[model samples]
Target: PFDSYRDAASTAPGTLPSPAAVGDLLGEAGVGSDDTIVAYDDTHGVFAARFVLTALAYGHEDVKLLDGDFSSWRQEYETTDEVPPVEPTDYVINTLADDAPIVDREAVEAAIDSGGTTLLDTRNEEEYEQRHLPGAIRLDWMELVDEETRGVKSGDAVETLLADRGIPTDRETPMILYCNTSRRLSHTFVVLRSLGFTDVAVYEGSMTEWLDADGATEAAD
Candidate 1:
């Protein structure tokens, strides 16, 4: 189910999953529209951020990510591998949220052309050195994470990191983020949003769609 958010029917790489796909998963889990959805994972909430952001974009109003992940939970309480049964509902998303932080290839291209948005590449050094979208400053998402707990760093810590990288902290500065399939960028998206960034967007198609469309790229030595 890790890839449940991907559009299986689409031939396009990095396609966003349909609302029905998301709804079906939530429906089977008996998730209600108004229910508070909390997400967490062992991978430092990087994976959890994907679900949190996706659910929010699909108009689930109260999605949240646990500050600490399963590792932190297991140390404090009992663990469970048991799956609980629940009544399913006909969950459906009527519309995407107006403030959904998603952008398409065209939008990324336009941003690149206009130089109006700060573009961040969330891939690691190897992938970035190979190829990356034009004008993208390499920002490994883990840079904003705490090495000890593998959790997101404090806001002040994040601010310092951003400032060191020369990234703008202005709330109105338009920013676009991307990784191979947006999985990595999801974490960055949430962190930036928490810092009160209002105009942040994720290139859901990410590098996959960019490569498919022959989008121009830059490389580092």
Candidate 2:
């Protein structure tokens, strides 16, 4: 009801907690592996993505990203501006890499060095210009939600967007998305998936951890 993860979740809205804290939160909430945990955000899916990855890392299964997210929902649906009671349910913990869809800094560096993946940054132009991962492509997710374009274009439109950025939409091309964190990337992930991009995944820690790493390299366009 607060419409803010920070207000409701007792943590920074777009930040990931320690692994132990993640486990404790899920356990205390009685979430089970089979439970459907839907995470979303008002802006890009970055916050939702971080939450998803944390859930997965903490061994929670059946997690999903809410399409269009809170902004789109508010535009299309009437929402109450009050906090609602949460019903705790038992969720089983099940961590599976293939199903979870996450990568670390080392994996990201290796992917870039080996030309094994395309890194997509969903942050805004200013953020992208400030600093970014080496060999990363900037594709602001907010632009895709344009009112004129209606929040998602056809497959052809997606193709055009990728082509303009010199990116191929081939299924075999591994695409890894990131932002300050994964919240915005989550929405981007859903959009890419809807546009028929199958090999898309997200980097969990993103630029925050990347910049903090002892020997991380940055493209800094």
Candidate 3:
């Protein structure tokens, strides 16, 4: 779902499959609030991040991403096409708006207007060079990840990466991260949260929505 666009449902690309459409996908597959889930994607954490956020939103507290994702797992283990046996659970979610680290376009705009956020452009250098939101500091999402393994680098390495970029790591100075969309940004969001950043948010609508709304952008020199 790269370069995804919004639909009538306000979801990226298409609407989420209805509860009936999947027909007990969660219940039959045995997903529950107490489950510690591990999500992964072929392309970095692009797709996995969404599942991580969704799981957390439903009050599933221990969601994690497969570092380097499926690729990394392949290096350490064998493949299996056969599905694992699912232990069903009667878990009912209390969809309370959000339990994930997400923010909308309006909140991002307000943060920018108030100069209250250290905005990080988590897209590639090429994208950032083409055009980026005003005041966004470029930091490619992959920089914090191990190229071969696709796994995120250590916390010490992450701290150094941010420090080198002059990105604030303090609790008070809020930070907002974004990419062309937000998949890449979501990876960084998780890493930061793990590092004890409590005031971080991701602009899920990101550059796509920002540009759609005629938001201001600037190109690299």
Top model number, lDDT:
1
Error at 177, model 3, angstroms: 1.5
Cα lDDT tens digits for candidate 2, 57-120? 4556578766556777887789887976565554343334356576777888889889967889
CA lDDT, every model vs. true structure: 0.86, 0.67, 0.73
Task: Say which prediction, candidate 1 or candidate 2, comes out ahead on lDDT.
Answer: 1
Between which residue pairs do clashes occur in model 3? 68-150, 68-151
Better of 1 and 3 by lDDT: 1
Order the numbered candidates by lDDT, best leading.
1, 3, 2
List model 3 lDDT by residue over 118-221, tens digit each: 99998999999999988899888789888877888888898888889899879566888888656677777777776889888777778878888888899999
| Per-model C-alpha RMSD | 1.5, 4.7, 3.5
Better of 2 and 3 by TM-score: 3
Quote model 1's TM-score.
Answer: 0.94
The residue-level lDDT of candidate 1 at 108 comes to: 92
TM-score to native of every candidate shown? 0.94, 0.70, 0.83
